[model samples]
Target chain A: MTTSSIASPDVDAEHEQNKTPVSFLGPFCTYSHQATLLAFPDTSKWVLEPTSTIKEVFDRVQSGAAPYGVVPFENSTHGVVTFTLDGLADRAGEYPDICVCGEIYLDVHHFLLGRRPPSSSPESEQRSSGRGGEENPKGVPLASLSHIRRVYSHPQAFGQTARFQAKYLQPLGIEFIDVSSTSRAAQLAAADPKGESAAIASELAGREAGLDVLARWVEDREDNTTRFFVIRRKETTEGGYPPPEEEGKRYKSLVSFTVPHRQPGALANVLDCFRRRELNLTSINSLPSLVAPFQYLFFVEFEGGREDDHEGRISGVLEDLEKVAERWRWLGSWRRKR
Target chain B: MTTSSIASPDVDAEHEQNKTPVSFLGPFCTYSHQATLLAFPDTSKWVLEPTSTIKEVFDRVQSGAAPYGVVPFENSTHGVVTFTLDGLADRAGEYPDICVCGEIYLDVHHFLLGRRPPSSSPESEQRSSGRGGEENPKGVPLASLSHIRRVYSHPQAFGQTARFQAKYLQPLGIEFIDVSSTSRAAQLAAADPKGESAAIASELAGREAGLDVLARWVEDREDNTTRFFVIRRKETTEGGYPPPEEEGKRYKSLVSFTVPHRQPGALANVLDCFRRRELNLTSINSLPSLVAPFQYLFFVEFEGGREDDHEGRISGVLEDLEKVAERWRWLGSWRRKR
Candidate 1:
């Protein structure tokens, strides 16, 4: 069996000993890992603890195994990271102790990483040169794909790089295999002795997994970015990242709620309230309530943070929502990141 | 490489001769296949044509390769089927020639299908007896899981059967593998020589793949149903299914739209129009517009068909939406299935 990058323990011994542990979805070098690294750059103050799943990231933080959790929230092209939503939603009756204390917008750039063919030379690399998008080009010209019969990557990566696949890979009739993570995809491709496979993953993932960069800037869009939530216990002040200097002090909040179904006012009762209050909602999404067939739970993220509700405007909106809606949940209110 | 069920032509010879062909997301026994089978039960009138992907389903219908297409729209537990949404949305300035003609609500019940061990007997099957959710039980007791080291199924099945996984599979340390379709998953499990893997798929899929019933009613929720849309050329009148009798004469329509961003009235204006009209919206979902980061396209399905808009109330709503919204696309106005 090809070894998984996640299967091997990659946490630093020094972090295990002296560093304050922070949780993220890991086996190292995933986008989540990259976000965790960026959000907590001071290694002396914090050690990165990577969990196998997003649920585990929430679990580790909730259980106090780690002080902070970083999980993918959304991608510009692909949209929501579903597991993170599942972890946060529908917690109405409980204490709802975990929250979105912060967010990270990581610019996503997927690379085609593959195992280098034995005796492969520079001329072959020139073939792959003209196909990539115009982005920050690195030092050397990259190699093009050769005999990449199969590709391994997270499904999200495939969604984000549709143009790349249609232009470069689909014509080749290559098989796309969905794995759990991009890092795992990179590691699996790296371990293939036949060199018949390549992975679409982050450059960091490729480097950590010992895969060669077959192509750079392989994603379909130039502005591919993913929003990640930096979460921890709602009441905990033990660990925190200072707000990035580039971000203004404006704040944002997310709340999940339910409205009576199959009626005009079922949802309008809530959305109009926001309009009436002038509470600018950033995004709104709905999922099945699970109690009944057509019932829905709505997750709404808005501009004003609960901490920054100086005029009690946000509270007034919620007060109206609580009365008009069947149920509501406060997920988090954190400093907004543009 | 294993041959895909989708690759083999499953269309009946007689179908090629006289019957109307309807496209479905297929490898011959997916939930979409089941929906297609239910909606087009009159073999003399219609023959089921299965496509490799949701896009292919849309393509076939649009290109008249098939007179109609059956694609999954949403799940009671899993929310929206994104690929289907992507196929329907963001079509402006171009004629959205393909439209949803009808809908199918299939009661989804997952079964653990696998190869029965060569030496197995009735008593060994007894151990799996009490684990499944109570439902309409069949004749003899089903076979129990034996060395089910891996499970093959669609990611949606994994989501719907989370309780079953947590209670039964997780404790056994079984690895969950995601495949393109549940029928493909069953085909893979049935093909495994060692009989160490099982699939979570429909009983129809199991029968098609020649896998045994390892467990029935494996889905976590009793109300695990999926909604599918019957799509065809917008102006085509050559073929259509008679709406199921129980659904009465009620109708539903879905329109995807975008409002200006970073302001309250941006979305609230459009929703308030629906509010003023008392239009009962069934569901609302948002996805990234892909033209820009954080910008969104909203898909809203509400009661009242455009065909039934005698008062022009529906037209009035759309008129206001067109005025306030940046862009919108009329996906379909189909007879709603309860």
Candidate 2:
């Protein structure tokens, strides 16, 4: 898992010599993999490192096992991934040299992948036996969700498809088997050749694992999506994203801070720093303070980049925010996903 | 599952007749049950309803199956319970008649419950065969965490005890079995009878389920606590708590609002409404908008009851807030949990 910067401006040389490896929580071919590919897509060139857990990805970044790490931050249907946020907060304090350098929004569509569709219909029988090479030549047949004895998936995937599960599977008394990752679910289904198990995973994962797609886009919400963050060492040349000078690009800055306890309107005072500067916050989440009750640590993402002037409003307001906050840390400024 | 309310003011009648049934996510003997008992402690008189899931608890409240619903909202180690938050938001939109009337904070202590200590040491041998009457006349022996084959508990319980699991169970290659609730885990371990399985659950749950406490306070953090909300139909006379007129009492209001998308500082404008009146925000969490990208629904809790007037500031500020927000809903204002 050795990694080196692809700093050469020449694209060919950059691809040839510095095959920068990026690590993500894995067994391979999960949504995290898709997000990594979407963010840096020269498959043959860039090395991909898959770790066992989200914390491991951060650990690799901190230990220099890999220069960059990708981890899911939030899902449209599931809200924020608290562990990811907590891990970031903790590692920031422990390893001051690591930060979120960029972010990617990955639109997720889960497919029920299995050895064969549950139904015994002629169409499904033919498709199950058919080589159905590239492109799944024959249209796949629908499976009887009720016949699914077991479902294997990451908890979040099950959460995203909760409505579907309740409507189609719960009444039939299907057993849900929780796995560490969606890809692990796919692997489990593939290994269970008896076709009694199915996994809710990306289409890419099914293909990579040589499994059939019993159902497509099974998520309850039409727009199931997940946001990912790319974390890298502070000294890296390419901060996991394009520079602001890249044409037609806009960026957002993430900031973490804590306010003194027993201070009335303390949060309002800090928020005013951004409001007065005309910075619109995209998201805000708070965690209770471990040291004191009724106190919190806030993580905020706003519309302007830390380096961007926004007509000189960004830097000055950030300076004032530092003064108002009991403790503050600028996470990073990266291209905002449109 | 028949339920009837005990509305009398007589303490004995309140205990014997009113038996106000309270609902919580179930398999029984979990932290939710402990919290419910802590909130309403006449166990013999008050009916206790245990729903199958957190969402079921909300559904029961919305459908009038139960007048009072108790659900965990957040944990100090795990942060906000997203599903609980989502259920609150979803039910609010579907059934505007329901509201959060009060809150309870319960200190959580997890114990490892098993049939017997996973060892044959002299102390354990004496207890393994010893009826060890009443309170176990002799102290039980310690178990080698490595010998345990399976650990069962809710995900949050496992998360709160990650360090212990990593240091002990992981090295021993123990299997983690996720259950609906901690009490369910205790029940499963009790049913096993072979001493190979242990459960991470409350001490009270262990006692109720007739399981031996192999280890006490097994959670990594001693200060682990969970905050719960009491939901009831809006027509309830008491609103689930003593009125603000009670001596030495304070109240907090929970509000949800949506600001105009694409409006610069729209949230700031709405927040300003609270700030101008000197209202202090206790916490704020945002959920992504389903209608548009980057838009959010903000849930904010502040330090004032809806009925209280800060020299007429409450009404004036709320009126202005309604004007600024595209949509607003006052969830409720009840006694602040100390």
RMSD of candidates 1 onward, in order:
4.9, 6.8
- Give the best candidate by DockQ: 1
- The stretch of ten residues in a row with the least summed lDDT in candidate 1 chain B is B1-10
Q: Tens digit of lDDT per residue, candidate 1, span B146-197? A: 5788998888888788767766777778877767789889989989999998
Candidate 2 lDDT tens digits, B188-306: 88788577888888766676667765666667677788999888878775333434454545788888888898676787788888878888788777776555654677888888786
| Candidate 1 residue-wise lDDT at A276 | 82
Clashes of each: 0, 1
Candidate 1, residues A1-338, lDDT tens digits: the string is 11232333566686567666789987677888778777887666877777767777877788777878899998888778766776777332222578888889899888888865666785554322233345425322255455788998887888777667766887788878777789889888988889889999987777677777777878867898999998888787764465346466789898888887676767877887788888888878878887678688888888887777899988998899889888887888888778
DockQ list for all candidates = 0.62, 0.36
- For model 2, the local distance difference test gives 0.72
Candidate 1 — which residues are off by over 4 angstroms? A1-18, A91-95, A115-121, A126-146, A241-247, B1-18, B91-95, B115-122, B126-146, B241-247
